[model samples]
Target: MTANRVLYLLGSAAPPVLNIAGVIERAQAADWDVCLGLTPTAARWLDDELPALEELTGHPVRSQYKLPREPDVWPPADVAVVAPATFNTINQWALGITDKFVVGFVAEAIGKGIPIVTMPCVNAAYVRHTQFDASIATLRVMGVHVLYGDGGFVPNEPGQGRPNGYPWHLALDAATSALTRRDAGRE
Candidate 1:
């Protein structure tokens, strides 16, 4: 069977952001051809690991928007997962903002009918923002699978989250299930 091409988008969250290699490994084990994309802050955070990440995924790690005439490097995504999806990314994406490469790719993916799954790594304090709930609601309405709350990533109290506690596997599993559901629907 052909592997599913997954765009593994990252945001600037503490735990999962630092464990990107593990995320890639999990995705690959599940038969996904994973491409890594990062928010600008996330890119900066993972600066020293860029080379290793590129080698891991066999594609350039994209953080910024490329020049208009530049050729696209990664394969077309069969699905996209934004693990450690930060509050900023979730809000901006809900508002259709694409200033960053990761956001832009996901925005376009939605229109392209690619199944997009997001597991937000936000704190309870930030979740109180007026836009946060509305943003998630909008994304869910747009058919983005937001793995938050009870069945997914639960909000931790501010400054209490441990790197080991982040649910990286849940994000991958949600992506896989979404792809399966999409395929089953086509059949």
Candidate 2:
């Protein structure tokens, strides 16, 4: 199977709220299979873009999981991205709680050695919390790439792209560069 399949786990963080498009665009350029894994909270913000994304990627966008109908038709993702990850989700996943399908999928991915990337978009208050720090440390130890969100640096104002601040495209570029390097060594 091609290793392009990606499970994008969404969170309620604001910056990731804006960076999802850039991430998806980058993933597509890298020939990745992008799947939208929305948390219950994320569903609220997905607004009208979810269906279009499903159509564009040609993969089912899922926030929940059912029994694998055919062993291959389920929530199996090669790479998983939890962007704008909330501390709640982080804590739950670290502790092995899968109440939400998104959390469940992440839990399973970690157990199976799937590469999972997490971009946390939280205020300074939550970011500095001790429990949040502990969760981040645990996730890193478990091989999850934790991407810190834009704090004071708002890429874009409300309802706009990061006009003047640090563009999220930079992150996408780095991710692609890393992939290119990995592929180069293989060749």
Clash tally, candidates in order: 0, 4
Stretches of candidate 1 off by over 4 Å are 1-4
The true-versus-predicted C-alpha distance at residue 77 of model 2, in Å, is: 2.5
Local accuracy of candidate 2 as per-residue lDDT tens digits, 1-187: 3545454535453545644655676677766666766776676677678777677667666666666673544445655666656668888887888889888877887778666666555555665668887887898888776665432222223355232243345444444544455457679
- Worst 10-residue lDDT window, candidate 2: 149-158
Error of 1 at 172 (Å): 0.7
**Per-residue lDDT of candidate 1, residues 64-91 (tens digit):** 8889999988888878888788999999
- C-alpha displacement of 62 in model 1, angstroms? 0.3
lDDT for 154 (candidate 2): 25
Off by over 4 Å in 2: 1-15, 68-76, 149-187
The whole-model C-alpha lDDT of candidate 1 against the native structure comes to 0.86
Report, for every candidate in turn, its global Cα lDDT versus the true structure. 0.86, 0.62
